[model samples]
Target: MKRAALVPEFTVPSPERLPDMWPGREVELDGLKAYVRDTPAAAPGAEPAVYVHGLGGSSTNWTDLAGVLAGRLDGQAIDLPGFGYSDPARSYSLAAMASHIVRWVEHSGRGPVHLFGNSMGGAAVVVAAALRPDLVRSLTLISPAMPFLDPRRSLQGPIVPLLLLPNAAKLAARRMSSMEPEALASMVIESCYADPTRYPEQRRLEAIEEARRRHLVPWYAEAYVGSLRGLVSSFLRAYLPGEGSMWKMAARIKAPTLVIAGRQDRLVDIRTAPQVARLIPDSRLMMLEGVGHVAQMEVPRTVARAVFGMLDELQEDKAGRAATQQVATQVRDGVRQRAPRVRMAS
Candidate 1:
């Protein structure tokens, strides 16, 4: 049974600055440079969580939420190969990305982690959990992109899924390359948040700076388009047998899962979250009324509360199992001590 939600004892953070978030450090995962969240003083044996970001998002997306959960979870948000500061690999398929993360979790010996993701990364984690259930202990998805399942909204730029076609995708990539980071970031904010103006000025400025940094990378646009294609491709394979599908994979997950979606989310349809929650056997779905795409970033305190609640449930369940095992052991020991001794004919 799920435990009562914890009342997180903290104020909701204003928009965060880069320096305030965990610094980026290079790490090797899948033989590629995987930039990850670096926290020098994370508590030992705290529940380890691996955070993944969406299309056009980097590990930096977890800045606020990770900080809030730091007391309870030792979090490492990864820059997925080709996005954020990570180097790109040849393959950009959803399965390939998920496999890379699976490798990272196993190689780093951080398995059975609480897997947290947003947008495209959210979909990737779902695939990872399905592929390597041993690696994921729980899943928390924020506006996971169900590309095939998501309908195109006008506020978002030209339908990118169809843009994935050869000529169109190339044209889209070129256009994005020419666009300024400020413009790009502003566009993202308008599309992502229900009320972008509601975001703090300092945070908005930091995001603009982040966009500028992203523009400096020659392959940034390529990475964004590749992620969009990967998401679309994954959506196409959802019901196919033996193929990696998020919906199909969700059914196979054995861990406790929490899915949070913003009622005003414009990217992946808000309707998708409920079905996702329904698919995962032991999952909880929480919808924030006035929130948008990035719930973890926009409402860290509330999101942290949900995470703590999941942790509470996990702890209780673990204790119960341990008690059962101890009782069984005791009963076996008592039977052995009290049993009558019979000598067999020699």
Candidate 2:
């Protein structure tokens, strides 16, 4: 395939240059508000890459990374049902969230796509690609949640996991509901950062503002717990015997894959990242130093370079395989010609 010059990577923009929010609108798919990235010129037929954010996160997570890849491919980041400004489904499960993603991709008429997922979103895309390989061309997973049960922290502090106990969902929701939006945002900003002080001040305000917007949703608290519960349940099932296992889903995925994580990641442990890379055949792993859980957000340009490198390698592998097949065909034809001719008996 002919190509345009690839997008330049690793040019980390100043906070002043980074948009507080990307231009977008909520798309109604099956009556759910699927907010997606609408800027950054996308090349036609280049296969759009869909972005899925982690638990308690929305499509806004892809803001920086999408800009880095905008020139090379079309991009869209979904606010997966109930997390962003989206409406809730009757039930929220890992499988159902993944299905919602699949439906959105199918509905958009963009298949064999370059799929990107972060944290819990990583698990969602794994399931989506496993269930419908035809819809994915490649997968880029950043700190995917694959069952590390050290729920010592739940974005707030060490005791948040205790809220998961039986008959605790409502109480947890009520307590979380009572906290100010800034307080919640501050906890997230603190937990996700390797140096909490370094994450830009303007972005901090944007995050707090984003949190305030979410607080306006009638069921935001319930949805948050529901999403968390679903992720924990998924972690437990990842080890079980069946097609449901995350390992099994990962093994079943046919798309070329990339797994990346930060050495200083506190939310999802870096140790678990390699286990995912080892389970998924032919996948690549890149562990960044001095980075945290949200690698894309913290160092968008660097992550873009890694993704660009992966795509370049994937293309080369395809070309090499094609050449090998052509050579084998030539060799077979030569053998046929060199073989002794059979005598006709009559």
**lDDT (10s digit) by residue, model 1, range 1-346:** 2322655556333335533657878987656788888543245668778999988888878887888777778888998887778998677788888888898888779778889989888888888888788888899888877544535542443565465467654666677768787787888888888878777676778778878887577777667677777777677788676656678788887888888889998887777888888888888888899999999878778888888887888889999999999999999999999999899998
lDDT of each: 0.78, 0.79
* Range of the 10 consecutive residues with the lowest summed lDDT in candidate 2: 1-10
lDDT for residue 144 in candidate 1, whole number 0-100: 79
What overall lDDT, based on C-alpha atoms, would model 2 receive against the true structure? 0.79
Best by TM-score: 1
Best by lDDT: 2
Q: Which parts of model 2 are misplaced by more than 4 Å?
A: 1-16, 42-45, 152-169, 322-346
- TM-score of model 1 vs. true structure: 0.89
